[model samples]
Target chain A: MSQWLTLFQKELLEMWRNFKWIWVPITFILLGVQEPLSSHFMPQIINSLGGLPDGAVIKIPPPSAQEVLIKGLSQYTSIGVLIIVLTTMGLLSGERKSGVAAMILVKPVSYESYVTSKWVGAMLLMWGSFLIGYLATWYYTGILFKWVPISDFFASYFYYGLWLTLALTVTISLSAMFLTSGMAGFLSLAIVILMNVVTSSLSNWMEWSPAQITTYANKLLLTGKIPDSLFPSSLLALVCTIIFLLVGIFVFKRKELASS
Target chain B: MITINWGLLAPIIIIQLILLVVALIDLVKIEKTNGPKWLWAIIIIVVNIIGPVLYFVIGRRNH
Candidate 1:
């Protein structure tokens, strides 16, 4: 317990030093702010700068505030997810490569403490950045788009956050097991992208899978509609997160910590 | 430029500048990088959001 706190504090200090504590949330806020403004003004953007021969009528109805927020969320899933994954991909592997992990592990730390500390630190950055981004988007939605009910916004935010948590779990596991940072990132990203694509294609069997929780969040935010699968979705994701995290601990416990 | 709304645009610019400044500071402070350091400095300034992101993820190996 105490060991975990020590390592977690070290991880936090590492995050502060690396400037992730600043840039990542700023990036998220940037993306969050950018999404709604662009979506809201797209028609104006086209009129002012969209090159057309003298007269070309293109009808674009202003999207509903809900739709605008949803658009922002879709942005989060794509570029935002990619950014989140890539920035933190090196958490464990980089430590190993730089010999930081070996030094820490040498000091009577449990493998569980090492991995859990990484997980906690990554969560702090990921959740902190994401919530700030989402709140900014929500505030902007209220101003520039429409005032969505706070309940719907919070509900969808929790659901979407869990989905990202699942992604983070996979990333933590991959970073612990893999030696090379790039490979860990590539494989984790491939898994996330694949989950969305494959789960969509295999729609029936995977509908209740955590892969669809993101879609659920979007829908709930856009229309305040709750899918019946919400509980099953949460349950499956929680189970998977715990299982994968435990597996990562198990793997790291046995494997010689990163050699390079 | 007359049509531009500076009020609306200011927040975006501020956030981006924050990212840019932090990235530049880190690039200068770090002792070494995965690639040439000068290229990273240029990329951080020119490329907008993606520039600093890539530099942090790839340029300096995390300590």
Candidate 2:
């Protein structure tokens, strides 16, 4: 237990030393803040462009506060997915690429402990950042609209964020297991986008496909209408996440680190 | 304050069991390498469903 804690602390400290917080939090906050701010102000901005000489007849309807909040949340959701994928892609792969794994292997830590600690630390940090961003957006959106229910709004955002985090973690684990550092990071992004595209394409045929999980969760949160189909999709995602992480760890433990 | 879905949980458990079986097969086949097969096996088994990822990231040989 002490060893696990020590490893966790070491990994987290290393992450902090690398200044990941700066880029990650900045990007998250920017997305969070932009979502509400833009949604609140877009109508005015559109009206300002109404002075077109050619008379484009741009009748910009004022978005309701709920519409604004939802728009902001959707924007945040997309950006959040990107940030999680990029940050996690190199969690393990980077250590191997920099020869840090060799040094760590020489320590008293077992391979399992070391890898588990890193995974836990990364998940905590990633999930923590996401929660922070969600809260920030929720608070600001509530302040802007003054009519949005904070509890319901936050509940919906939280579930959506949770699902996104789980999906990205699986992608990261797969990337780390299969590719080198540069390739791992790129492949993580590719895999995520590909999953989205493939699942969406199959959504017509597969009634309970993973592609609709995020959308369904968001709808449930927003409207308080949980579809029976989402239960299966979410279950599938959870199962896939566990499988991917296990496969990654299994492959990593026996990999030829001498060449890595 | 989220509602738990047992029906959703069922499929996840099934998927995990399937993954575990697949991982065990891989571990058995790869036991003859330079490293301690038992240690690798334990790592894969103990890490539960995530063990395979660690194996892939740091365990397997290129050849």
Candidate 3:
């Protein structure tokens, strides 16, 4: 137990040293604020920059507050995931390459403690940042637009978080499996994007797919109701997260952590 | 002087400045990076939200 605590502390300190503790949340806060602020000011912005001829009153229909919040989640799916992938893609591979992993492993550290501590630490960073961003977006949306029902917001938030954690787990596991940070990043990025693309394009065939959580999230916010329950998707994503952690532990045990 | 809606826009500017400053500070303090320090400084300064993020993600030499 104490060993795990020690490893967790090291991970936390490493996060601080890398500036992830500060920048990750800041990034989320910025992303959260950007959506509502831009949506609220879109008309003024276009009028000033649209460069239209005089007297042309282009009456663009204003999007509902629900739409604005949903748009924010979609932004998170893209930019948020990219930032996360880039930030964590090197978590394992980089440590191994830098000889840090070997140094720790040589000193009576078990693979379970090492891998689990990392997963827990990474989870703290992701969830902490996500909550801050989501709350900011929610508050801004309420102030500028309208507040969606709290029940719906919480529901969607849970599902979206599941999807996010699943993606992050995949990233860490891939980094553990791969030899280089670039490969881990590229593979995870491709998978994240590809998952979204496939799920959107073939949603009819995959009613229970995990990507359904993202769609369900948007709808839950927009209509204050979930068109379909997200139980299956949420469960699947949770199971996948657990599997990824296990795989990471196995890989760390079997593979040689480069110490060059 | 043109009137500006500082109320709505000031937050964005403030947030951006904070990110820039923090990124710059980390850059200065870190011993080594993936590339030249000057390049990263320019990137963090020149680019908007993404610049500092890019540096943190790709620039730092974790080893």
DockQ of each: 0.60, 0.02, 0.57
Ranking of candidates on DockQ, top first: 1, 3, 2
lDDT of 2 by residue, A174-246 (tens): 6557546557766767766777788778877775666577677667655767777877877776777777777
lDDT by residue (tens digit), candidate 3, B1-63: 234678766876887899899999999998999899999999999999889998988888657
Candidate 1 vs 2: which has more TM-score: 1
Model 2 C-alpha lDDT versus the unseen true structure: 0.65
Docking class of 3: medium
Model 3, residue A33: C-alpha shift (Å): 1.6
Off by over 4 Å in 3: B1-3
Per-prediction TM-score: 0.95, 0.72, 0.94
Task: List residue ranges in candidate 1 displaced over 4 A.
Answer: A258-260
- Cα lDDT of candidate 1 equals 0.84
DockQ for candidate 1, please give it: 0.60
Candidate 3 lDDT, A1-260, residue by residue in tens: 99999999999998988778888988998887788888888777877786888898888787888888888887777888888888888888988888888889999988999988988898889888988888888888888888877777777678888888988999999999987989999999888788878988998987778877898778767666656657777787888789988998898789987644
- Chain A TM-score of model 3 comes to 0.95
